[model samples]
Structures are given as structure tokens and as C-alpha cells.
Target: MRSSTRFERDAFGPVEIAADRYWGAQTQRALGVFDIGEERFPSCLIHAFGLQKMAAARANLRCGALDPVLAEPVVAAASELRDGRFDAHFPLTIWQTGSGTQTNMNANEVIANRANEMLGQPLGSKFPVHPNDHVNASQSSNDSFPTVMHLVTVLELEERLKPSLVLLQESLRERANAFANVLKIARTHLMDAVPMTMGQAFDTFARQVAHGFDRIDATMPRLLSLPQGGTAAGTGLNAPPGFDVFFCEEIRALTGRNFSPNPSKFEGMAAHDALVEVSGALNVIATSLIKMANDLRWLGSGPRCGLGELKIPDDGLTSSIMPGKRNPTIAEVLAQACMQVVGNHATITMANASGNFELNVAKPVLIANLLQSIRVLADASRVFAQRLVQDVEVNGAQLARNVENALLLVTALNPILGYDKVAQITAAALEQGVTPRAAALSLGLLDEATYDRVVDARTLAGRPGHRPEGFSERS
Candidate 1:
């Protein structure tokens, strides 16, 4: 029988690798040593490594640091890797070296071995395509991994998260238009405060999401700046001069993004402040989502006993033991997702502070948390828009009843009558369990004609024709 494993040698010694696997000795060594976590790098990050390796090879070839013969197969293999042809070849966890050096070498070994195989050589042969000498030419994990970090971040944000946010914002705008005339009682500090249209509340949510879009836009310029040619210690080391420009140019050409090299490579590798800024923005978004979600859950609390202002969508899956109970399942899910993002931002902030003098040793955890936040937030935003926000119905009868019974409707009387008088009326209404209009008349605070004219909920909700900027009411 054929042997199941074959021997591959690196600087340390020879190690046995699976016969069909493409990764070489260093990756196998990492597998043996850092077997702590099951959290392997995601496919997007692995694909980013593929693009980085490909861009590096092209840059090295342009800078005369690599031979054309070797560049050919390296580029081909790297393109395949970028397209996810060899996803299984990468098996290292995020618990490895802080610089992600082992994962970088994993990419190099897989690309180099694949390139060698394409040239009719065995997998372990460090022949024409050496993993370090050629495949990783003019690059170091310190610089390259951070470059990959920025690339994946920008791609995920622009391609996934931002679009989902836009969808949610538009969905909220639609809801605002749909409920623009439906006046409801507003609460502040968990007490009845005043009257507001449901449209105004949803419009506020839309504006919050719009601000989230602006925050993400503010981070783009810094995130697009890469530090590829910094190499091991931000010294450029063995990398050729002008390699940074060439690498970014090749990356732009390959990915069609306007990526440029950072003026200070040391800052890029040593401080992940840009990523921290992104996490801060994500944290703000998480807080906003939590506010909206909690408000929704409160408004949609119950059909019989709770606020009953909103009718949450029923997905045919009610509470396990309580039959026919419609819970705010989507809002709860979204709030939980936002909570995780908030926790992720805290982790990212702490990880970013772990940056030392020349290199941040917490890169793997940092990027992992960042990407996880982006992905989950994006998915949650989409689900919130499609599953919950779009299907929510207004409890018009309940809203009317609440608005009629609200003691805070006496707020509209404050401008006409004195504040103390309005407070007395409100207190009497609460004490007698009577409507504010009845309380005002019974307390002789105002005549019935004046109270009816002043305490109208619709007029008290604020001016009509109020909509978020750039939003038009749909017919």
C-alpha cells in the first residue's frame, strides 16, 4: 500500500505531512504546536492571502526581484488560491504566532508546492518555486498580513456591510412613510412623556443608520492604504526599492480597488489604530441597533397585556410551551447580534493596544474579531430589514387608545396654562384613572372647548409633512 504521509523538510527538521496535502513543513509544525483553538481563519482571509501573494509575485517580477519563469506558475497557483481552489490546504488556527507568520508561510508553501506540481515536480521539492526564496519574495508576514487585513476589511465593508446597512436604512424609510400619520404616545424614562407619530420614531432610526453609513465612509481612506513592502521590521529589509508602489498598483489592477501604499509603513504594522477606529464605528452602530431593537421589542411587547402598539410578525414558530404566542423573535435576535458586535469591539480595542514597538503581536485575533463583527452585523441588518421591519404592522386601535388615555397629553396645555396647573391635571388624571381631558375639566384647569382644541394628539405630535431628508413618501 502507498504511504499515507510523506516527509517535508524545513530549517528545523523533516516532518511527515499528508501525502495529498499541499502545505509544507512550517504549516505542519504550526499544527503540531498551536493546536489550541478550533477557530481557523475564514475563507475570505485565506483568499485575501492568495491575492496578496499574487500581487507580491507580480510586484517582485516588475521590480526584477523574481525570475519570469518562477513568476508564471506562482501567479497561476496564487490566482487559483484566490479563487478558492485550494481552501482545504490551509489548516492553521488563529492561535499561532501573533504576526500570523505561520499562516503566511502556509500560503507560501501551498502556492509554492502547487506551482512545483504544475511544473511536474513533487509537492515537497523546493525546486524552481521555493516557498521562502521565491513565493514569499520581497515580503514578510509583518507587512503582508496587515496588508491582507486592510484588503479583507475594505472588501467586506464595501461589498457586504455597507449594502446591508443601506437596505436597512431604506426599509426604515419605507416604514416611516407608511406610518407617518399614525400618532402614538411617547415614553421618556419609562414614563409617558408626549405624543409622536410612529413615522417620526422610524425616521429617527433611519437617520441613525445614515450616520452609521457616514462613519464607515470616514474610515475608507485610511483602510485603503496598505503597507505591503514594509517586510519584517518596517525597514523594507530585502525587498527591492519601489516594491510598495508596484505591489499596490498590481493589487489595484487585480482587484479593481483604489488601494495605495501607506506613507509610514511603521505605523501600519505597529499600530492598528485604523482598525480600532473601524471597531469604534461598528460599536456605535451596534448601540444604535440595540436601541432600535429594544424599542421595537418594547413597542411590540404583547397583544393583550403589554404596550400593544406594534404587531410583530409571526413566523409560525411560537414559544416552545406557550401556543400561538407571537414574540419579537427578530428583534431579540438582532439585539443579541449587536451585543456580540459590541463585545467584539471591546476585544478589538484591547487587541489593538497589544501592539508593541515594531509590530503588533495581536494581529490574528484582531482581524478575526473585526471580520466576525462585520459579517454578523451585515447579516443581522439584512434580516432585520427583511424579516422584521418590512412585516411589522401598526396597532392602530391600540395607538388611538393609548394616545387618548395618555396623561402626558397635558404637555400641550403647558404653553396655554401654567406648568404647575398641567402637572396637577396629569396627577389627578392618574389618581382618578380618568382621561387627561376629563381630568382637566374636573380639576377646572381648562374649559372643555380649550382643552379639546389644545390637547389634540395629532397637532401635539408636531408638524405634518415631516420626513427624513432625501426621502419621499411612496404612493
Candidate 2:
């Protein structure tokens, strides 16, 4: 190990740390032991880690628990971490300790070393600001990790995810209003059932997205409840009096988000139902996006053969094997992204359940999956809004052709000709590949003049100013 340069000793004995890195002995121990997947918690959490520690330092300083000489360097080091200057030091995998203690100490050690260095001390010197004793005072891994989870999730939801959903909803709403007069065949069981305005179809999808947004809004209060005051099995032992309240206040100032302590620290520590609730709400959104994406892909399936209600926006990609062929690339990728989020919710559910009596040990997996879900959902919403949903074109000519030829249009004649007569005309129309108008004429079910006036698709779709076949309403 390069002649054991820059050794630091912990309870585990002397271990070598990377010479240029800021993390110390405990973090080095974790790096040696856990060699799981390369996927790490994102750098945003590192920034959150910095904000959390800095809040603790400020809280302790205000309460006179920390000496000003020792606290200033810690505050400065934490600001660097929060500002994203020290993300490289937090390279541990997401599959580390169950309570995220390794990641916690990872943050702790880096801050301690950086703080000491600011005082003209060497890298390994823990004199002025010891990692756990000074940097982590009034906190524990159990409380601190979960608190950062809340901070990162709530901030991202407010700043990124909610606004993206609004953009998507507005895009869909615009299309609905624009297509208000365009009539199309509505399908059930993949077969035409009735006539309806295309606006109705797009409006239904917009409502689904709006409903998902409302569901998430309802869960925000529960998600914002922080477990930071719990401090190791919800007991808050070895912490200064009134530290929890002060910590929450400092964090509120730092983030501009009021994250209050959970009413029951034992409940917060023993189960992660709040984060699971957030994931569940996101899962429902994933389901909504998946449905809309699949609908878009199918509607835009073919320029020549399929439903052809829509034309997908050109994404500048082509099939390497087929010439001049474009795909619904954004919608397809959106489906895949939503599927990953649904699967992540499953992982979170299991982790949420695996926690025991006083403390849940599956915090790292929960944190990893929750953050991943947020990123995927936010990214997919933006792409769907800008590239696909906003840009997709309605095939007006195709919709007109399909409505004119639809065998199901025979249903509109049911009241005049009765159900049996209309069914016969529908079967004949389907078998001969002819318009229902032609079948009605051949079967003597209606005259040419009556067929022309009665089969107006816009009238059958209940559009305003519709008058059917000049027959009196009382008759």
C-alpha cells in the first residue's frame, strides 16, 4: 500500500487513507469492506450532508455548547461540502451499512479533516475538531441520515418534480382544447365502440396526471416530518438539551423549508412509512405516465397501417436496418423509465418493512431508491412534455377517414332501425370492407338522403348544433 503513507487510527486500528483525500479512518474502513455495485447515492445528498452538519454546527454554536474557536472551522468545512466542493470524498457505494453510518462517518471525517486543515493543522490531526466527538455532536447516524433524506426529497419535489408535472399537464390541456372539434372513434377492448371528440380523449389523460399531482400533494406533510431529533433509536441520549428544536430551526433557515421533528421519534426511527408513502405516490404517477406513453406510442404507431391518430415528433434517429423509418423514441424510453420507478417502489416497500422494533436498518436502500425515483420521474416528465406530448401531431385526415368508414357508426341508427337491423348492417359492413353508409343503403335500412344526414360523425358525438336526419324529436 505504497509504504503506508498518511496512516490514521480508529477503534479498528491503524489504516492507510488516500493522501490527497479528506475522509479519514472510519470512511477508509468502509471502503475496504463493502465492494458492492458501483451505484452511489447522488451528489445532491452530499450537499445535503453538508447542509445537515453545518446546521448542527450553527445550532451547537448558538446554544453555547461548542467553543467559537472550534466551531468556525467546522462551519466553513461544512459550507464547502454543502456547496458541492467535496463530493469526490463521498465515494462509498449505496449498499453500505444498514443505518448509513458509514456514509455518515464518511461525511463526518471529511468535515473534521477539512476543518483541522483550515486551522493550519496536518491532515490526520483530530485535535481541534474530532470527527464524531465534535463534528457529529448532538446527532447520530440514525437521525442524521433520515433527516437528510427528508431534506433532499422535499426540496427536489418542490423545486423540480412539481413544476415538471405542471408543465406536462399544461401541454396536454393545450392539445385537448385545440382538438375540441375533431371527431374520432372511441375504442374499448381494442375495437371501435362509439364516436367522440378527440378533445375528450386528451382531456381524460390530462386529468389523470392532475390526479397524480394531487395525490403527491396530500402526502407532503407526512414526508416533511424529520426524524433528526430521534438520535439513535429515538432516545436522543448524549445530546444537548433542546438541541432537536434548535436543529430544526437552523435547518429551516438554511433550506427555506420548514422540516419539523416527527411527533413520535420511535415511530419515525422504527419504520420509514413516510418515505414509503412518497414512493407509493410516485409509483402511482409512474403508472399514469406509463399508460399515457403507451397510448401515445400506439396512437402514433404507423403512418400507413395502424390507428394513425397521431404522428410522433421526429427525434432525428433512424432504424439502422430499415431506411427512412422513425420511431416513437421518447415515448418508448419514457415507458422504460417509468417501469424502473415502479420497480424501485417495490424495493422501497421491502426496505420499509424490514426494519425491526426500535430502529429500521434498511435506510441506505430506501434513500437510494427514493432519490432514483425522483430523478427518473422528473426527467421523464420533462421529456414527455417537450419532445413528445407537446410536439406530437394529430392526424386529422386519418381521423376523418376512420370515422367515415367505421362499422360501429351503425350504433347511431339503433333508435330508428332497432338493434337487430343495425347489428346486421354492422356485420355486413365489416365483412365486405365497405363503409357502414354503403351497407345501410344495400340492406334498404335507410335512403341515401337519410344516410347522408344521419351519419354526420360530429352530430353523433353530441357536438353543439347537431340535428339528426330531419326527424322530429317527438317522433
Candidate 3:
């Protein structure tokens, strides 16, 4: 029978590796040492590393640091890695060496072994495609890991998160148009305040999402600045001259992104302020999402006892014992997702702050948290738009009822009756448990004709003749 494990040696010593695995000795050691968490780096991150390695190989070849013979197989192996052919080989958790050196070496070893196998050599034979000398040529984990972080951040934001935000913004705008004339009672500090249209509320949400897109767009320039050629420190000691420029050119070719070398590699390697800034943007988005979700939950509170101004979609989720309990499951889920993003931002903030003198050792955790925030926020935003926003039914009867009975509508009488008199009318309405109109008449505040003329809810919603800009007049 064939052996299940084989021996491979690194700078430290020999270690046993699975015979079928592409990773070598160092990866085997990391698998044993950093067994702390189940949080392996996501497939997107691994794929990004593949792209990074492939770009490095092409850059090295362009700079004449690697011969064409070795470069060919290395490029092929790294491309395969980027394309996810060797996904199972990368098994290290995010809790590994904070510099992500082990993960970098994992990529190196995997690509080197695969390249060697392609060259008709055995797995452990590091002959032509040495992991460090060729596969990791002119690159350091400190620089390469941060470069991959930036690459993945840009790709995730542009490809996933921004599109999702656009979808949500458009969805909200559509809802705003649909409800343009549906006047409802507005609340401040959870108490009835005045009148507004449901369209105005949804338009506010759409504007918030549009601003989220702008924030991410503003963050992209910083994210696109890479530090790949700064090798071990920010000095570019062993890297060939112009390697940074060539590496960026190769990266642009691979990703079609405008990746450029950071002017100050030291800042890129030592501080993750750019990533923290992105996280702060995400934090703001999470806050906005939480606000919108909470608003929906409150607006959809109950069909009989609560606010009941908005009808949440029935996604078939139910309580175990309740016969027909329909919960605001989508909004609740979206709120929970945003809450997790908030927590992830906290972790990312702390991790970014932990950077010391030369290099940030918290790279793995920082990138992991940032990627998780982007992924979950993107997915939740899309789901919230498609599943909830598109299907939510406005409770028009309840909205009209609330608007008609709201005591705060007395503000419309303030111009003629004055603030103090309006306050008395509101107080009397509350204390006597009557409508504001009834209380105003009881107090002889004004004639019913003037009150009715001024307190029209539709007119009180906004400026005269305002109809949500792009919406048509109510039929």
C-alpha cells in the first residue's frame, strides 16, 4: 500500500505532510501549531493570495529576476490557486501568525509543490521551484499580505458591496415613489410629532444608502494603494528596482483595477488606517441599516395593538407555539447582521490599533474582520432589498387613522393660535382622551373652519404642491 504521509523539510526541520496535499513542511507545522480557531481564511482571501502570487511571478519575470522556465510553471500553479483548484490545501486559521507569514508560506509551499509536480518531479523535491527563492521571489509576507488585503478589499467593495448598496438605494427609491401620497403620522422620540408622507421616510433611507456608496467610492483610492515591493521592511531591500511599479502593472492586468504602489510603503505596512477608515464607513452604514430596520420593526409592530403603519412581508417564519404569528423576520435578520458588522468593526479597529513599529502583526485578524463585514453587509443589504423592501405593504388605513388622530397636528394651528395655545390644546387633547380638533373646540382655541383648513394632513406633510420630486400626483 502507498503511504498516506510523506516527509518534507524547511529551514526549521523536517515535518510529515499528507502525500496528496500540495502544501509543504512549513504549512504542516502551522496546521499543528495554530490550531486555535475554526476561522480559516475565506475562499476569497485565498483566491486573492493566488492572484497576488501570480502577479509577483509575472513581475519577477519581467524584471529578469526569474528565468522563463521557472516562471512559467510558477505562474501556472499560482493561476490555478487563484482559480480555486487547490482550495483544500490552505487550511490555516485566521488566528495564525499575526503577520500572516505562515499563510504566505502556505501559499508559497503549495504553489512550489504544485509547480514541481507539474515539472514531473516528486512533491518534496524543491529543485527548480523553491518556495522562498522562486515562488516567493522578491516578496515578503509583511508586504505581500497587506497587498492582498488591499486587493481583496477593493474587489469585494466594487464587485459585491457597492452593487448591493445600489440595489437597496434603488429599491428604496421605488418604494418612495409607490408611497408618494400616503400621508402618515411622524414621530420624534417615539411620540407623535407631526405629519409626513411614507415616501419622505423611504426617500430618507434611499439617500442614506446613496451616501454609503459615496463613502466607499471615497475610500477606494486609499484601498488601491499597495505595498507589495516593500519586502521585509519598508526598504525594498531584496526586491529588484522598479518591482513595485511592475508588480502593480501586473496586478492591474490581472484584476483590471487601478492598483498603484503606495508612495509611503512604510505607512501601508506599519499602519492599517486605510482599512480602519473603510471599517468606519462600514460602521456608519451599519448604523444606518440598524436605524432603518428598527424603524421598520416599529412601523410593522402589530396589526391591532401597535403602530401598524407598515405591513412586513410574511416570509413563513413562525413561532413554535403561536398559531399564526408573523414576525418581522427579515428586518430582524438584517438588524442582527448589521449588529454583527458593528462588532466586527470594533474588532477591526482594535486590530488596526495594535500595529507596532515596523509591521502590523494583526494583519490576519484585521483583514478577516474587514472581509466579514463587507460580505455580510453586502449579502444582508441585497436580501433586505429583495425580500423585505420590495414586498412590504403600507397599512394605508392605519396610517390615515394615525394622521387624523395625532395630537401633535396642532402645530399647524400655532401660526394663528400661537405656541402656548397650541400646547394647551395638545395637553387638553391628551388629558381628556379626545382628538386635537375636539380639544381645540372644547377650549375655544379657534373656529372649526380655520382648524380644518390649516390642519389638513396632506398639506401639513410638506411644502405646498410638493409631491416627492419624481412622483406623479395622487390619482
Instruction: Please give the clash total of every predicted structure, in order.
Output: 0, 0, 0
Better of 1 and 2 by TM-score: 1
For 122-197, candidate 2 gives per-residue lDDT tens digits of: 8888878899988998889988998888888888788788888888888887787788888889889988878888
Question: Would you estimate the TM-scores of all the predictions?
Answer: 0.97, 0.93, 0.96
Off by over 4 Å in 2: 1-4, 446-455, 463-475
Task: Give the least accurate 10-residue stretch of model 3, judged by summed lDDT.
Answer: 466-475
Single out the weakest 10-residue window by summed lDDT for candidate 1. 466-475
Q: lDDT score, residue 169, model 3?
A: 83
lDDT of 1 by residue, 276-378 (tens): 9999999999999999999999999888899989998886678789888788888888999999999999899999999889999999999999999999999
Best by TM-score: 1
Q: Which pairs clash in the backbone of model 1?
A: none
C-alpha lDDT score of every prediction, in listed order: 0.91, 0.86, 0.90
> Candidate 1 has what TM-score?
0.97
The number of residue pairs in model 1 that clash at the backbone is 0
lDDT of 1 at 124: 96
By lDDT, the candidates rank as 1, 3, 2
**Clash count, candidate 2:** 0
